[model samples]
Target: MKTQKNFRPFVAAIAAALLGGALAGCAPLLVGGAAVGTALMVTDRRTSGAQIDDEAIELRSASRLREAFGDRAHINVNSYNRQVLLTGEVPSEAAKQQAEQIVGRVDNVRGIVNELAVMAPTTLPQRSGDTLITGKVRASFVDASDLQANAFRVVTERGSVYLMGRVSQREADRATSIARQIAGVQRVVRIFEVVDATDLRQLAPVSTGTPATVAPAPAPAPAAAPAGGAVVTPVR
Candidate 1:
């Protein structure tokens, strides 16, 4: 009976280890599914058409990028409301420039932020670490009560977190603060198209016979395109 009991504990330990390994392997897929489902439920600031356009931009840009650079570059194309943020590494500066040009030709791309470095591609382990950092930053946003976590898109490359969203100044500041607090985030770069509180309020559906409010002042002009085809527009 004692021998059987010892064997049972060993079996239990093996079972626990197998279960842990299974959960670890499935974590990314499960998280991705949850993210997509949550995104569908949220009231995003972008119009439905804009959302579709952003998806299309990512697909088309990626296709073109593959055709141009193939294995020479490791590029990530992320589009939030038609603004594309390109990260990863290329073999040369020429490949980097070509990436931007290819993405620029995609339909409905309002702007591009090419943060691609000219170096050897990052290994899988580095990419895995970036994914974990991104998850931490995203969880921080979800924990903050005042912020609409769904409004921001988090992308991490080599520890730099690129935040893309259509958000107000206050929300942008709050997100930046949260991202900076995360342990692995080396930098937080804002790629937000900043709107005012009034704009955000207007996003809500109006009821019938609601009194009209005064029109808000026009938004400031977007910042000029930065050199090398990366558009980093500051909120004025």
Candidate 2:
């Protein structure tokens, strides 16, 4: 329960570690008493090792992306349990496919949700709006007593909201509905690794949460993504 007060990991993730000192507020498990990283691991569905790997995956894939596209693309690489979700803008279709191909080569990456749009990078105002929308969505999750805010990871890009995490089918639908109600959300995407209720209980036996995490969603069709889940990723 102590860690609940510091439940803003989404902000850190969405900002792609660029929040710097701002993230320090939630990074510590104490103020928060425990190691901040340790605190997150306690509640995260991914094992501590997976959490670490996710970080590495993001860093490695991002470095590759930057090398491949430089200032031409605006990509945000988010790795949750080693399933990387790529969001942002690129100049061409070739750039988009190249981005996915580059990320797919990263070590430990089991799959990818390539949500990169073939367009120019968004302006600061638009990105700032996306940040605010992300904040509002996160606040809504916290306000929802039925859900564990930290159980979800949110990404808002150009009004579209993405949800990601390991959760139950009921949690997925509930979380989706919650996100869709947010005023500025253009759409809600589900990149959830939906688990059986029995398995969810096994992960957190005392958890009574009714909603899950956010990943970029589709507006009209399923992505060409491989659509893998937590089960096949093979980790603790």
Candidate 3:
């Protein structure tokens, strides 16, 4: 019986050692994978559509809370899997309730977790700056015909602008380009919604610059010229 008990202890030690070694080997792979994922998330102008949607929900929630509570509320919105978690501070019970109401209004919002502390109201200057940043980015979308601004949610932290939107590859590129061109943009993080090429092709390119005279869209029929008249097919 003693020998058998001793054998069990030896077996347990071997098992533990194997498990430790296995975990050690997996550590580097796990780290590498995480690094790659993070890099892709940060660098790729085109990001997964689902992630963009989540970010949109979060941003809209925070923005609505900001509007309803005005300078009274300081809110942070975080989303995961369509669920929004609202955390921050407000000055009163009414303000906290108002924040909840605002979050509820955002579309695609699954659930909310309000963790707001009642405190002093936010300053006028801070609120004004937030409004300015939001208005500028929002107006840019409204003016740009080719871009879908509504698909995105804009969030401003300090001087930085965070854009969240679902988009085609082309739309992602255009959006990033526009954000970069904006004068005060500190950093643009693309929480883009990517779609297939077929869907992307359907999006029309906006005409803003000099007008070009070109042939009309082709009709799906054979064209014939009158007798002695030549039919001209433009050369590429």
For each candidate in turn, the TM-score is 0.71, 0.74, 0.38
TM-score-superior candidate, 2 or 3: 2
**In model 1, what is the error at residue 75, expressed in angstroms?**
0.4
Best by TM-score: 2
lDDT of 3: 0.47
Q: Model 1, 115: alpha-carbon shift in Å?
A: 0.3
For residues 1-236, write the lDDT of model 3, one tens digit per residue. Answer: 99998676445534433332321111100110111145444432333453466556755665566556555556767553344444445778887787777777787664554545577644557544644554566656655799865455554444444444335666665665565555555555443335555654554222122211112214312122221111111111
Name the Cα RMSD for model 3: 23.7
> Which regions of candidate 1 are displaced past 4 Å?
1-42, 204-236
Q: After aligning candidate 3 to the native by TM-score, how far in Å is the CA of 13 from where it should be?
A: 68
Best by lDDT: 2
10 residues in a row with least lDDT, candidate 3:
25-34
